[model samples]
Target: MLRPDDRGVLYGEGVFETVWIRDGVARLRDAHLARMARSAALLEITLPDPAPLVDEAEARWRADGEGALRLVCTAGPAGGEPVLYATVTPVPEAVIAQRADGVRVVTAEAGVSRERPGWSLTTAKTLSYAANLAARRSAGDRDMLWVSTEGYALESPTAGLVWLSDGVLHGVAGDGVLPSVTVAHLLSEAGGVHGEATVADLDRSDGIWLVSALRGLAEVIELDGRGRARSPWTGRLSRIVSRRPG
Candidate 1:
């Protein structure tokens, strides 16, 4: 149980990692942990040793089962020790469906300036997610693509954005967007470029995808009511990222 004064509970001061578990093993475990550590450091929260929690997650996973594992570290009650915990749960069916079928997206103003000073936490996976969740809720049936006040495409509420233009892969980059582990892995396997994007650029792309740990890659069939032609590269790229690391 959490204390009333815990900073995470009282002020949303925390960091977390959501790992995709496949066949009882956490996929990209090291990457997730490294990101979490970075997030913790940004918040000045000392992360506890993760080995015990990782072992516990491994023990809970069934031989051939799949799940989502969450590891959380939070600022403890006032000046107390930082709190840490882990949980494993089934991956939502909707996430799996989106991975196979694809998703529709709508771009919206993020309401925050990407160039704002002292906002280094923008790229961290911190627990202050109310704004992100609200953006998704506002999008309703379609997922939301957060854009800067200047019309530059940033990223989605939960996933990173990647697109194919003239047969080359590209991703949204800079301090404004969260550095996506899934996108990095995909791009490392299949060469890609990283730079700023605009709605017009996305509209003219050969294909667009929302990349994440849980969703893998969801092709964008439609964007802002405009239909996009399916790219032949989707299947080939998906196969590349789906391969388990040796």
Candidate 2:
């Protein structure tokens, strides 16, 4: 439990990672911890050794079976150690269904100034998610694809974009977007580009997929009410990421 003055509660000072677990194994645990450590350093929050939490997450998954395991570390009350916790919850039906059925999305202005380059919190998964939540709420039932004022596709609130253009998978340039671990892994396996594209340009692609730890690879079947053709690569890409390392 958090004290009344916890930094995470008062100022949203913290970083978090959502991990996908299957058969008691937390997928990409090392990559998740690396990103969390990078985020903690950027925020100047003292991150404790993650070994205990990692063990706890694995134990919890063994007892509870497959689900989403969220690891949150935050700056707590002044002069106290950072607060860390692992919460495992059932994966939402929509998220599971989207893995196979795909998702429909609408575009929105990301609000943040993507034109001005900087190493700010945009790359970190911080608790100050008010803007991300607002974007999702604005979308209602559909997912929101954030685009810059210059018409460049940014990313969704929680996932990264990967579209197939002329047989090449492409994601938004790493400059302003969060460097997605999932997308990076997918690109390493299947090959892709870190570049910019407008919504119109993305729509014309042979296939569009949203990559994330939990979502795996969900193709964008419809964008802004326009239907896209089903892709043959979705299943192959899914299997590539879903492989459980021995």
Candidate 3:
């Protein structure tokens, strides 16, 4: 286990990946590691060898039966005593069920400014997730939208914001702080993924859903506390991918 005194705990330094593990296998292991490596580089943190981490995950998966995996990499202890820690947690049935029904998401966006230097932390999965937690809490009335100050639809605390326009899958495009592996795979497999959409496009639509690795995809029955059932496409998409548990 990673210590509370580790650099991640102390300075909230280092990147992490919440990779999903199910059926005795880990999904998108390569993409997650690649993102981690990219994030670590942006932070100028030295990443430990990936082989050991891979071995650890495989061993733990075989030992613990299997579920979802949380991979965390920090700067380690003050003097470099702590190393990266990996843990496995069983995937909650509720998560899958919610995905089945589709999760509602409040529109949220990340603000990148000259002072904030978006490149510094926008892409890295740092432990300083207080803002995200706050975004979740700030999601008052359950349907609140947390869009960018500029009104661009960024993403949700736990899910990527995916919308459909003219039968096309349009998602937000940027550094991909969106945690878009599932969507990425969806677009790659299904084809025709358009990024760089505006919140106006989403609002003009019939509905929207919050997306994530765990929840997969959940529909937004409402937006900004408004009661709206959403388009039939939500159920259709959910069902279309039901047979394949990607």
Candidate 4:
């Protein structure tokens, strides 16, 4: 948790990512670290060497069981210094199972600042996660958290852009929000490209997914607070990830 005195806590300011590491190997560490670095640069904070952090995470995965990895960087409690860290943690079995089965989702307008200037760090995945966390709290077990602003579906609380349209891959604006490294990786793996879409477009697509590194990928089995009937594509995506070279 973010400490009270932490700048990222007092004022939302930082960037972080949950990486997908399996069998002690991170699937897309480079992409994630590069994104983190870009975010830190945008925020004007000095970044610690991520090589050491990745080494540590890899060590832990070897010592522990296979699972998810969460890397968080804070601006420090004083709010004006470089403080970065990362951790390797297990993806909840239940969460993974849910991903395998698929999840329900609700889209709500994001409270992003006009310029996103609430001392808030929209680009940085900082500790000031109150609003997103609250949205998650209000979400049901099957509910995949979503944030939209001005009628545009931005992203999920902890996941990346979810776009669903026949064979055309889609994602939100790259510069509008933080770039989703995991989403990018999946798009590459699927031999697909990122396209754009509306919530309605998603609803009328061939598949819907909440792509993240830790969970690899998740399909939205339910939508608009309704339990959507299961589809075959969900399992197919899972199999694809499973067969992917680690």
Which of candidates 2 and 3 reaches a greater TM-score? 2
**lDDT, candidate 3, at 211:** 62
Q: List residue ranges in candidate 3 displaced over 4 A.
A: 1-5, 55-66, 78-82, 108-119, 140-145, 175-179, 239-246
**Model 2 lDDT, full chain set:** 0.85
Measured with C-alpha atoms, the lDDT of residue 27 in candidate 1 is: 81
What tens-digit string does per-residue lDDT give for candidate 3 at 74-171? 88877774366677777787777776554444555555421345555765667788877887787754534455656567666666667777777666
**All candidates: TM-score:** 0.96, 0.94, 0.82, 0.83
The lDDT leader among the candidates is 1
TM-score of 4: 0.83
lDDT of 1 by residue, 1-246 (tens): 578899999888999888888877788888989989988988888999886898789888885766888888889998699989998988899998987788999999887776867746887898899998998999998999988998888899999999988888998875567789988888878889887778999998888999988888899999998988888888987887667767
Worst 10 residues of 2 by lDDT: 110-119
- Please identify which of the two predictions, 1 or 4, would achieve the higher TM-score against the true structure: 1
Q: Flag clash pairs in model 2.
A: none
How far is each candidate from the true structure, as Cα RMSD in Å?
1.2, 1.6, 3.4, 3.3
Model 2's C-alpha root-mean-square deviation from the true structure amounts to 1.6
Per-model lDDT: 0.86, 0.85, 0.65, 0.68
For model 4, give the 10-residue run with minimal summed lDDT: 112-121
Model 1 gets an lDDT of 0.86
Better of 1 and 3 by TM-score: 1
lDDT tens per residue, model 2, 154-208: 8999899988888898877765677798888888778777777899899788888
Q: Write one digit per residue (lDDT tens) for candidate 4, span 18-60.
A: 7777767776778778888877777666777777878777877
